[model samples]
Target chain A: MSFPPLLEDLIRSLKVLPGVGAKSAQRMAFSLLEGDRLGGQKLAKTLAKAVDGIQHCTSCRNYTQSELCDICANPRRELNGEICVVATPSDVAAIEQTGHFQGRYFVLMGLLSPLDGIGPDELGLDRLANLMATTEVKELILATNPTVEGEATAHYIAEIAQQHNVRVSRIAQGVPVGGELEMVDGKTLGHAFSGRKTL
Target chain B: MSFPPLLEDLIRSLKVLPGVGAKSAQRMAFSLLEGDRLGGQKLAKTLAKAVDGIQHCTSCRNYTQSELCDICANPRRELNGEICVVATPSDVAAIEQTGHFQGRYFVLMGLLSPLDGIGPDELGLDRLANLMATTEVKELILATNPTVEGEATAHYIAEIAQQHNVRVSRIAQGVPVGGELEMVDGKTLGHAFSGRKTL
Candidate 1:
């Protein structure tokens, strides 16, 4: 005996969310149905609007309702001639929070994974190349994650930057500020030691 | 600097799901926006339908699109004249999965928490009482959680059962079938000792 059809559908549909499984989906469905019908309605409306309206930014491949994302549309952000290339839009949000980088961004949206059929074309490397070649961008910062695919994606984009005669650099990988040295992973500790700076 | 307006709205909306915080919401939003727009649209449609269509079963208080839930609508389930009272619809599902009890259910939807303003009316105890007074229900099984509020609710419902001259029984509280004696909590162990029966 399963749940009523509508409740079961809600639970099954909720599993579309990342990291949500059968149990979590059922809990979410029950919670919404039991108490937060208004919140559930609002979420449904917002999700529908977002799914229908949001599109990739024409220039940077980031999600946006408009043709260009807010960051790409801003003229002042382009003054530095520096373009940061990252794997996803959330990466852009993270960098923006730092308030240090004053340049534009190029969101790859994904990395190169041959086994999964994700390659340069899937990452929109051609768009990133065109942006670099057409614009007077002075530097390209590779800020993908520390994963193997991220490194490969960064290297592939570095080659594109080299072809465009744009100076390319990678973000520093080291021990995080609040992270204890002993708790740091071997690869990160290795990077920290190799990339040590003089005081 | 934040995410695009639509993306931000989606993230905020996703936080309505239980256990989803800002970070998890952001990840869910990105996952949907990045690759699962079809899934997102389906979820939105299903969620909207569920929020608008799903309502309580008039008899059992379980979620259903129609007037009566499947179990309550079936004639065979009422043969034994046994009705199990539970705190939530999920509890009904749990009892149904066991297949041991061939009876109908009364869903309280919540425990009796006076501090939270949840009392008899909130749990629809009057409806339960009406059912008991009118129907041929011979026994009412209390299957609420083992928490304090659950016990209080069970006792409260037991009083109603007594008033209606219906037999009342509380599910046994003891160490689980596979639970280690040392790992069992003191309260459960004490109940296990007091409620011990001949093998």
Candidate 2:
């Protein structure tokens, strides 16, 4: 059955969400309209507030309402001049969830994809360079993904940090923790063997 | 890093959507706030409009912005005295997609689940009674799901329609059209054999 104009519009708008196709968008729209009208209202308000209020952190490029994100604003995070650079805010959250990284983060917001018109400027590489030059940076941790673009972006960032005499380290690329050696890919296994440490 | 208040609230509210967990909600929030602010505003307006505008169709209990849904309002749909009774609006959409059934539909909105406090009143069986009393309904097609609750709901609806001298017919239940003989379960195989059609 054909839906009303507003509902059709709503379904179409819902499709803007990543991974939501026509069928999923219809389901979500119907579920919200039928089962959870209040929840739908809350989502609407939140969406409006987020779009209107949230902005990029001046220092790290992470999403925030203020000029600086919580991490950048916190004095505790500035204790050491160590920074972990990542491709997305989700990666920052993943690292934060582990409660392991104490230093601040520099979010690239995206990888350096020249084909997609996303270059070092798109990734705010100049801002990263400025941070490295101004701060008493001790180490730069390259925590981007292990994809080809990730590797290239890491190399580019490393070059910038090296020019400024900042030590650079990359997150290990090998068999994952608790991964079976037999199931490891040939390239990963080769890297694991080559990067092996003395017992 | 802790998200700002608005971003955090947006992420939490996003979890209200079906299948969205904390991480997915966070990702959605960030994507909207960072990448698609205008899309986010559009979604918000559409969501609010949908929630405020859509209502149940007075005749079939299907979702619509007006008193009568498209099917009920259409003159072509009222040519026959046949009504397909199903549980939800999705079922109506599924039936409509096939384009086989030309008759109107009566959406129960939900099946009979006494455990969940959904009884005859909740399914609007009285409204079905009212429709039978007023309309020239000749046949009441029980097109509910083939589950145990569906069977019970169908039977209950059938009894009500039978009392009004309306013929009751059920959609066939057996091995699916494309199902393999070996893969078919015992009950379905039995039904398939029992309900075999003449050549």
Give each candidate's fraction of reference contacts reproduced. 0.88, 0.74
lDDT of 2 by residue, A77-185 (tens): 8886789999988898889999988999999999989999999999999999999889878899999999899999999999999999999999987899999999999
Extract clashing residue pairs from model 2. none
- Looking at model 2, residue B133 earns an lDDT score of 94
Candidate 1, Cα interface RMSD: 1.1
TM-score of chain A of each: 0.94, 0.96
* Residue B190 in model 2: lDDT: 92
Each prediction's TM-score versus the true structure: 0.93, 0.89
Candidate 2, residues B98-160, lDDT tens digits: the string is: 988998899998899999999999888999999999988978999999889999999999899
- Measured with C-alpha atoms, the lDDT of residue A191 in candidate 2 is 90
DockQ of all predictions against the true structure, Cα-based = 0.77, 0.61
Q: Using TM-score, give the best candidate's number.
A: 1
Instruction: Give per-residue CA lDDT, model 1, range B59-123, as digits (tens).
Output: 99999999999999999998879999999888888888998999999999999999999999999
Candidate 1 lDDT for residue B156 = 96
